[model samples]
Target: MPHNTIRTARCAALVGPYLAGKTTLLESLLFAAGAISRKGSVRDGNSVGDSAPEAKARKMSTEVNAASFEYLGERWSILDCPGSVELACESQNALMAADLAVVVAEAAPDKAVLLAPLFKFLDDRRIPHILFINKIDTLGDQSVRAVVSAYQEVSTRKLVLRAVPMREKGVVTGLVDLVSERAWRFNPHKPSNPVSLPDALKTDESEARQALLESIADFDDALLEKLLEDMAPDSDAVYDSLAQELANDQIVPVFFGSAENDNGVRRLLKALRHEGPEVAVTAARVDAPAQGAVAVQIVKTQIGSHAGKLSLARVWRGEVADGMILGGERVSGVFRLFGHEQTKIPTATAGDLVALGRLDKAATGDRLTDANGGKGNLGAPADWPERPAPVYGLALHAENRNDDVKLSSAIQKLTEEDPSLVLEQASDTGELVLWGQGDIHLRIAMDRLRGKFNVAVKGQAPQIPYQESIRKGTSHHARYKRQTGGHGQFADIQIDIRPLPRGSGIQFEDAVVGGSVPRQYIGSVEAGIRDAAARGPLGFPVVDFAVTLTGGQFHPVDSSDMAFKTAARQAIAEALPACEPVLLEPLLTVTIAVPSAFTPKIQRLVSGRRGQLMGFDARPGWPGWDEVKASLPQADMQDLIVELRSLSLGVGTYVWEFDRLQEAVGRAADRAVEIRREVLAAQ
Candidate 1:
């Protein structure tokens, strides 16, 4: 094959904290690669990466945007992922398809802690990544080295500075490449111009370069020997070592620039071109088959207005052509995306990220293959990051009755695009609940529902699941007599009611003797008792009680199943209130996981929410973290995640399950009963 036709294809993902300029960096990369003539601005809502209406309105990326371009004879696909912590799932999914990742970061050292989870995720997956310190122009009076050191503290891997800032009068105007020994000054809207090294900064540059060399030498015995011998290594050899070490996940190379002004972007691209692994290496790393067989993994799914359902997938193996049979479905179209715009393509090969149309059955993270549908392993490592627990939830309902019919379908599409968003139908409350990482996350989902799917919904706090049970026992006699046109209905029964132990559930027994009531009518009586148990006197499901049928009378002709059932229901309804009914609140064993620094705050938070702290200990496998075990009322957990994040810089998380049902007491219990009474009255 000719060199022009035989192109090298690779992909990289951009990820970082909120407002870290990841989208801007993507725009800069596109401009530098000549894919776009002018760079688009996030502030102006013209950036290609954030083309969705919700993203443009909020000025933040809500989903992953994939774009492919050619630079210097090489084909590249860049996945620009959302930076918001709530949207981090988008980044996680996109990372599985990339050969490398470019982690963008803010220049402030104090905010370096925000990158803790992201760094841990990268390190845990052993995914090779490099750091891009963005917005360097805003680092007023802050030392870049200090920022680098702060980042190093969070990252488990060694952080190697690839360049040193060229500061003149305490302002960084350029950078000196440590490997190539070249200096370049930033030129806004144009490529950085090469400049001679300044004599004033020679000593600092040399020290920074020496530190970089030492960090690399730690992983290479030959490089260490050369360094110990006081020998200068060749520039090509140094670059090769850096690339090799980075690809091996042994060191993280750091670069700095302002993506808004397009500074240092070309240099970043050059580094990627030289160091990033090819598709073949990535395929092997994930254990994908070497032979070129049709295999694709759907990374994302979106329902387009004009194009219909589009599944964004990375072709992991053989060529995927339009109308090809894949996983029992025919591909409708193959499109290569340029931000929001897509161009129809005849075929896509290995390492190409393209959108396949009309694959309604294909969901995000689905591994698809040819008609055989064999050996499509998604290429995700065993420990791929799981979706974060929902920190916020809202009970949602359609604003218009007509939309209610379409609500479920719309939500399905929304979750199909973002697996992070969870939709639940509350079993007790019967409310449609939408759970997500935060308010912003849910808001974006709602926007997508309304804007894209034309579903407008009303949202409110989710309802707590509260139950009612009897505290005491009572016995009563009841009779049901009705006169009809021909046959009169008559039934009588005597029953004993008692409270059982918590979690024992409802129990029914027939202690009748001598056929006081026929065996057949006894079943009707039991059924009636159970039907009435669905709602106790306190307007909630009743549990932990027992009912015994002691005796009953039935007229042979006048008595029917309905009469016996009515008598049994009437007996329980009259006796339950007199039995000292009490409200039963759900108790959950909550294990609060957070950094040790915020353990005390978490304790206070639990106490304030009427929770009992059982104990606390170091969280297993997570250093400097603690898990506080507490028994908390279900009512207090509605906003726990919101408060937890506010206290722990968004790193705190917890797991909880129903432990038992405990009797609610004090004014809280009284308030709950009163509110439930009002709700029942309204219904």
Candidate 2:
């Protein structure tokens, strides 16, 4: 029976690892809802989610995409999030606004490990999710139970299988709903056809139904009592328990489907319509206001060259009207987004995820309220997903120097859309470095630079910020006596140089007596020595050394700041070569979080990269995972994330910070110095 009346909109975020068929499932879901005439394929570059040129070029989602549809008189807005691990934060932002989440996964048992991070995040947040084992047609005689059991290892929430597969010889032909115990055969691109239960599956279905009942009974005392008394609980009672437990995020319902063929999509939609939590439940979960106060949380922001600033937000309470004053910024337009198409709406209420036009001051994760007392009132939740730390960086240069201003503006807009991107001007390297989660992430940004912003740019590995320090030091006396004109330059200085402890930095002092050097000229001598330290004999910043002026002579007529400064620099220049200056590279204290099974591989990878292992322990609050701490050289840490993900099934991640500097004394040091010299020559 279909609902006869229209209802309010609900939002769901489709999330999973890369290649999990989320985009394909989006197409099928829209087709089943009669929102689209035909399904678009991701490979064909025609899918609604692949509207961006960057996404189409790679045939993968580069960012969060929004789609809306109506089914059975109930409207829905689906947030189609990127699946790559590098873009996990993008999914987190969208999930914060959704009423529920559909965790799509491939039906491969070995790939279950890939869900650990996402499962931990969802479980930690108590977000209600359904595990949909997609591409079941590719199961290849493997039972869905195996896949479910594999996933159960990673998820803390109880997983309740909703259906049991029915196979013909070795191939799955249909499935039986555990609650209804009704068999239905799949019809491609259409509704499943009901069929009588096969005799062979009767016992299987009975066992599965009992399991489902028992799982839900754990949360319902009445159901538990009925089961204990050998009484068969009604299907309605089972469904009610399932809905209640799911709303409370106590369990994860499991379903299987081949979304590419449009099989089982209707059942998923029906389940959502019947079991999904209301906007009130989500509002309470996120601590949204209880009253009719207008508030919206900006989950994602998209800045278009033509569309201008579009803030995709969820209306958590009250109604937001076009031209309403929110946080002192007038909402220019209220739009319901469908990929690239935006339909102008007069208003949006709670649970509606729409794009607001021209809220320039608004940013992602801002909760805008109607508290406009002439001052903006945008509150950000503490649980707002922290932007992932940059694990990769590239020195970005405009292909045409004339486009430098445009490049920076475009990059700023890109950062607004994806907060994970970080732009920095390196003090040591003097390069405009852009930091991100990985190379692919930075590549996507570069693509958008050329494709979306029409700004030409190029990228390369950023230069390492390496410093040079002295192991030994000696003193030298320098004299600047240039008799070029009537005013001849004449200054002499005797300085004692000695290496201080590491991290002591470059220091300068004077111990001259008898006022041999004028008081004003002493400051110039110190400045010149500091300036000389900026570019040492090794062509890098010098550190952990000190210089003291023992005695000096000067001609008052010509010995100005410039003469003293020149003589001080000359003294240091002559003293540095004999001081045994050594190359020093920065080391980072890295803490890597990964499944325990990959800890050994991580250790080996670190060891291969000149990393010294500190220790490893179970990750706090995350079961079955380990946090491995190590000290790695900054030069070797560049591609560590890339290799770590390759070794850990794409789930390994780490945080790193500068710990200290270490002396380099091998071929690696020589190679680094060689590269530095070459780079300097080029410049």
Candidate 3:
């Protein structure tokens, strides 16, 4: 695809911190471009982008929403993405589909700090972007200037002023255009009426215009020569340089406006139409796909009411028809998504944001390409931000017993929509667990289960798998005899049990000599010993112990497998109590990365949670963060994450790997032993 061939001239994406009015801005743009008749607000629960029930309930965007509009003879495609840290990956995925990212910022200087991560992402990808200083009507001139300066201080690219706020009686009334040297005062109460710029902003307007021209002059030698000659540069030269620099991300033009009141929105739209990256130029893959084939990237996977699975894809090359093969399967249908509503379209071409219906095998970040019959590798661009590992988990089960099968299928669908969510069945404990980014992320996932899939579930904390082992060696004897029948049963055995090293698990050996016990019955005795060990004297699985059968006697005719098994079970049960059973708790090696300023607090938190700090290292790329490594009992880790998140303001991240199970002694171990013994006796 080429830039000149794109019907949609502009490809821009919106991103900012949570609740920064990104969706509202999109709504305003749509309304201005005539794509929508009336603008919808988030508070009213009627925004087009926030049509999902989960999004409406939370009043936040959980995924990317896209729409296109035409303004001033050029078509524009706009993508609105979630801003919450938990859903930040959605924004990254949107960026991959965008050529220019418009970072919306509030008037408050402190609020601008949240854009650091977004700026870093754009810079790393070498993606061009611009800044929109929004909500100027709410702040004074001095405050707005301070906020602008704060943004300039943080940004590596040149912050060029493309517009200046028109103030009237210490209030922002309109904006002065720096490029055209024109101004208009906005009537907030009556958006249809446009007031003239006040006389007092003349000097400020000139200064801003001069600064804008100087910033562009350095980019073109012709403009520099014209400036050296003390003459104004050609307007076309200035416009060309601005467009080229903005597209290349060398300069970020700041546009002043208030999205809520639609102040300067028209001017902003014109600037985007002129300065934004063309869809055809920007749609070229960051990394090209395989040749002689069409490839489309699925940026989002959304569940619909009656439409079922809708894959929001951007076609990079070629054309997709109703029945064209994608990923080796025929496409069911292609439709354009308008929230929950769908409009079927025939033959979507390159750079179209069309929804593919009934794409059961499609998922977010999947590349749908022409699949050749032969086995050949098709090189596709890597998906944006590899799926994040799930940090929090909950054990879940279907509330209705009959819904068990449906629950598994529903979970699979949810995972397909959001690949970051992880599902696992704990084979050791027979528990089903769902893992996600955080509490809210998991909550929304569960809500989707009941709301979208119509499957209800119950969730609870998983039981920590505990093990029991012996401490000291002990010997015992057992005998079994039956004389009620013609063929009587008789067996005698002596065994010794001892503790093994940690992680050694269970081991068995026999040293019986000279036909002390029949070899045929020895295997039966071992099976009986294992059955006894499955439920130790402490009511838990026994491990890290050795059992030896040193001597045994069996009658040739009377000794049966059952007789020897009973004798062996009785011998082990009798010997285990004398061995002084102890509890062994699973230990996890936990590593936490946090800012150094909070290192002391994190250390204290770990100690309070019964965790032993092993060591600490400085995080490589992060300046103030330190990685703290610790070993903590699995029982103590359940709620520790909640407290850790609270202390670190949700920035701290940690991962744990299972370590060896160790003997748990003292009061905790004693309590566990008592509980296990009570349970075993009851059983």
Candidate 4:
């Protein structure tokens, strides 16, 4: 092995769109590295990356899975990330610690757009990555060139195709290495068998090789000069230039493979082993000093049923050892993880990703440097992307009343595992609401709550924050008299109520001209009126109104604050209905973001949802995207993201805040009242 290939730890991340075969690629890589004697299939629920119970049940990854092994004396750790957009945060955190990323994608050209967001993230962070087009054998009708072209449309980096598939009667049976100028036939369970260049593929292969050279030469002036001078560069020079440019994130090398059959697995491993940057280089890239006190950054956190809390961290400087202190907590243990299993290790050096047991204070994306013989500094870089806003929510309550107390702590742990989820106590509705990226994201969270945390919850769509306000004003006189025995209660009051402008919350004042009502009892009467305002005849909290206490009579011998409070309550109950109460629904000023090409569709979407369009313009800082501002009823926003994404190829999103409350009249108001009645009845 070369000196650069000396035994050193490096991390790679596997990420892409849902069902892009990232898990399968991880298996193939492990098998090729001799870490696994037999590759387990996802269909069998035995793949190393998706070993969690939740993942097995859904046949998808629910969190980041770490697997480490040694190949040819070099240590390697690969993080298999969830492919669903709902779980993109997991992939992003893992990517921060990666020396390189292998973005696995489908071979079809039309589906290439699915990689846009991932590509943008890598490009923005200047994270070195390679595109591995998996399942090439399944590409019966698609041309590699067409797929490459489509990918290039979204990718900011120059793409260099490293190899061309060698087809036999329209079937991809092998591929020709462009740099080596050699051809090989794929062997299902072993390294590809070398073959002579086929006569029919000669022209296509030569053209593809030339294109690869040109793409790489664009970043290498010496190679560009050599190419312009019509002088061929040696394969060593070409490989050297390729590695250099890739380390700098100037270009993305494209490799094709069929992970299911293990073809191309060995070649990909060789490339990663030889070309991936070293730990020292990664430290320099992130501006972290190459030598310093031990520093570790937690990329993922998992609370295993038996293992307790584990913080998966990447050592950026120095070494981490069991019993070392991090973030004011002792590192209880250190272990190397492979799927669900782990091997206890006493120490981990720089560039090594190991799980530190019982780092309860640690969280994903937190950086901890050695401090006073313990870990410290729990901050991520300022440039890290903010968490995505929630687009869906559910009102959840424990199925069993006894689990109510446990539910909050269970959900806290759940959100800890996946920070994309949010939990809130909706003050308007008094219901516990769980917010997430989509229905799937919330479903998985609920599953964990029940299966792992033992808290079963019943869930439903969140209630809209509907309100009610009076349209007119009225005055009422009320009396409370009770003569059951000694000190019989006697009180009388007159109050005036009136409507205020929209969004003006309930107000109370005393307009009394004399002490017909004692000043101390006046406060008690106002309290009664405000309490009455809590519920309107329309079955919601009343707002945008005021109540004035004009006059009241109280018998000094027989009257108490309770008696006056009851009289005031009766006054409000009778006065509000005659004031013509109207229901008010929350209106959100939503800014819908979508590709410019879908602006017309978004306009139609807004209109169809009973929304008023404020206008639209190009989205700031996002190329080829538009932001359509509109005011929509909160009821209409429940499924708006779903519809918008459907129309925008799953790239659309929006941000919204409560703009105002608009009066709801006619059948809409009646329907809302009926729904509220039904929900209360069910509760």
**Candidate achieving the largest lDDT:** 2
Candidate 2 C-alpha lDDT tens digits along 1-683:
22224477789999999999999999999999899998899899999887898899999998999998777777799999999999998999999999899999999989999998888888878888999999988988788889999999999999999999878878777889988888999988999999999998898889888898888888899999999999998888888888889988999999988899988888898888888898888888889743337878899999888779999999988888999888668999999989888999898877788999999998899888886442345557888888898999999999999999999999999999999999998988889999999999999999999988999899999888888988887879999989996898889999999998889998888899999998989999999999888888888888999999999898879888999999999998889989999999999999999999999898799899998999999999988999999999999988889999999999999999899989998998999889988877998
Better of 3 and 4 by TM-score: 4
Give the runs in model 4 whose Cα sits over 4 Å from its true position: 1-6, 289-292, 681-683
Clashing pairs in 4: 325-374, 325-375, 326-375, 327-375
Instruction: Write down the lDDT of every candidate, Cα atoms only.
Output: 0.87, 0.89, 0.77, 0.87
> Between the candidate structures 3 and 4, which one is better when assessed by lDDT?
4
Tell me each candidate's TM-score.
0.96, 0.98, 0.86, 0.96
Candidate 4, after superposition: displacement of residue 131 in Å? 0.8
Which pairs clash (backbone N, Cα, C closer than 3 Å) in model 2? none
Off by over 4 Å in 1: 1-6, 290-292, 371-384
- Please, what are the lDDT tens digits per residue for candidate 4 over residues 275-388? 888878877787663223888878888886556998898888888889877767889999999998988988898888999999888887777877755646657766556788
lDDT per residue, candidate 3, 367-419, as tens digits?
77775741222423654676666667789888898999999999988887887
Question: Whole-model lDDT, candidate 2?
Answer: 0.89
**For candidate 4, which ten residues in a row score worst on lDDT?**
283-292
Cα shift from native, residue 283, model 4 (Å): 1.9
Error of 2 at 66 (Å): 0.7
Say which candidate scores most in TM-score.
Answer: 2
- For every candidate in turn, the CA RMSD to the true structure comes to 2.1, 1.8, 4.1, 2.2
